[model samples]
Target: MQIYTVGGAVRDRLLGLSVKDRDHVVVGSTPEAMVALGYRPVGKDFPVFLHPESHEEYALARTERKTAKGYKGFVIHADPEVTLEQDLARRDLTINAIAEAENGQLIDPYHGLADIEARVFRHVSPAFSEDPVRILRVARFAARFTDFTLADETLTLMRQMVEEGEVDALVPERVWQELARGLMEAKPSRMFEVLRACGALQRILPELDQLFGVPQTAKYHPEVDTGLHIMLVIDYAAAQGFSLPIRFAALTHDLGKGTTPKDVLPRHIGHEERSVKLLQQVVKRMRVPNDCKDLGLVVARFHGKVHQVCEMRAATVLTFLQETDALRQPQRFKDFLSACEADARGRTGFEQQELPYFQLLLDILKLVQSVDAGAIAQAQTDPSRIKDAVFAARVHTMEQHYQFPLSQSVTGGSG
Candidate 1:
């Protein structure tokens, strides 16, 4: 049997990127023969084996035939007769269809290297439309390779797939998995752009889709379009090396603006609460993680105050931290601040400045958290009064230590 390194390892190496993992395809090998040679069979639908020493995967040369609908509706045929060309031809993108021989010789029957050089994301064959997951995969590739452009024909095929209801058949888990991965990529906005261009985003994430034509107050958001502002926010978060939860918060922080009343054009009075409500629906529908869902909801609810934190009184600041559960989740609280900074800088001319109040707000959270709440609790006679005493004490400490902007003030220390 001849083993050849294939897929991402080959593609990444060709792009001069550090290869993360190596996948191999074993040609002219049977499952029984592989088992006899110390390779353990592990594949569920096709013949895939693990190396005896390295434990790396070595899938046999296989061909897939579309049997039904969705990503899993595939019939796999693996045998000694299957050629490497056949296996490579079934892949989605041209750059991912290249393989490398054991002797370091390249086996490129699909001109993947040329496509890589051209920074083009071209499909290997029409089979790409057979798997609905390819739509997500292409979007993910657009996010990862920020410089690459999708081939017009490939985009046309994707649009046709969406029109044919292929994207609708994608399972929720797979959709979320791909979307989350895309969000963490270098330029995540490209993923949404590709999805929107293909008409799949409106089908899958209608809340986010509705943001495109929505307007925002130009004085606050020079970008003017709420959707464009959020995309800029996501890119800024990515540029800042923020975590996935932070990026997700940037993406969903303004969902309510999409539903603003026509009479309130360019003004979103209670969009914060509306954003939180929409965030809850998305969290349930996407099966988002508790941490991501919780953070997105909090950021959506309080991002306006977070942007204008300099105007908040000590009690309002304390309430903001408390509502976000910052005392218990200090790290996520930091992430929340980072995402808010992304929002502040996402505007057209504001990109040059460090977010207006990062260090200032950070000092407040740190100081309030440093307060001895247990002592305040012990000083209280009534148990129910303890919580209120501690909060008052924290607020008092903030009031004494920091100076807040008086241009505007938020009343009621509850969000």
Candidate 2:
């Protein structure tokens, strides 16, 4: 049996990129032979074994054919007679289909090496349509390799796949996995762009697609429509290398704008609250983890609350923290600020001016952190009085820096 490095590890190495994980394709091997050689069989749908000494995945080289709908409908055939070239032909992308021999000789049966050098994303074969997951994979690859562009034929095939309704057949788990990967990449805007071009965005994330053509009031958003705003925000967030929850929160923070009445003057007066509910539904449909869903909800719910809190006293900050569960996890306060920054950056002219509120919120957090732990503990006992004391302290600090009155009317007072 001969083992070779394949897929991303090989692709990244060719491009001088840091490879994350190394996967091996074992040719001329069977499950029985692998077990006899002390390899542990682990895969259920297909046969995959773990190296006895290395503990790394070593999948038997195999060929597959589409037997039904979706990605799981594949019929996998693994045999000692299957050539490595045959196995590579079934891969999704040309860049990923390239393999390396055990002696480090690179194999390029489909000219994947040329595509990689050209910084292009190309399908290995017409058989790319067999699995719906490739649609997501290509988008994710775009995100991961920001410098690469999809080949015209590849884009056409992706569009055809979307037109054929193949995207709808994909499971939520697979969709979310690709989405999470894209969000974690250094540049995710290209992912969304590819998705939009292929029409897959509307199928998987209609809430985001709804932003397209949705007009934003020119006075506040002069750059373009709400869709562009959201995309710009995602770009800025990705540029900052924000965490998964933070990046997702930034992307969906304004999703409610699509559902708001167009005739409304402000158009998005109470969108933060509405967005929280909409995001919950979207996350549920995507099958996101509970923690991520909760974080998204919290960021959406209080994303605009910082502006309202800017003029309030120290006690108001304390009450707001307690009511919103922000007090329970102090680090989340910083995360909220990061989300607000992304939101502000996504907005147009007037929206950009509102960044002061985010800065003010950050300043308030620092002020609160400066207070003695004993004082905060004492204030926590009586949640009712917490707002007043917190607001007062905040006002005292602000009076030293600005001309505005230290005290301002507090809304949602019960918190």
Clashing pairs in 1: none
Give the TM-score of each candidate. 0.95, 0.86
Q: Ten residues in a row with the worst lDDT in model 1?
A: 406-415
**Per-residue CA lDDT of candidate 1, range 173-211, in tens?**
899999999989999999999999999999989999999
**Backbone clashes (count) for model 1:** 0
Q: What is the C-alpha RMSD of each candidate to the true structure, in Å?
A: 2.8, 4.6
170 in model 1: Cα distance from truth in Å? 0.8
**Top model number, TM-score:** 1
- Expressed as tens digits, the lDDT of each residue in 277-338 for candidate 2 is 78988998999977667677887888767656656555565567665676456677677667
Backbone clash count, each prediction separately: 0, 12
Candidate 2 TM-score, C-alpha based? 0.86
* Residue runs of model 2 more than 4 Å from their true location after superposition: 313-319, 348-415
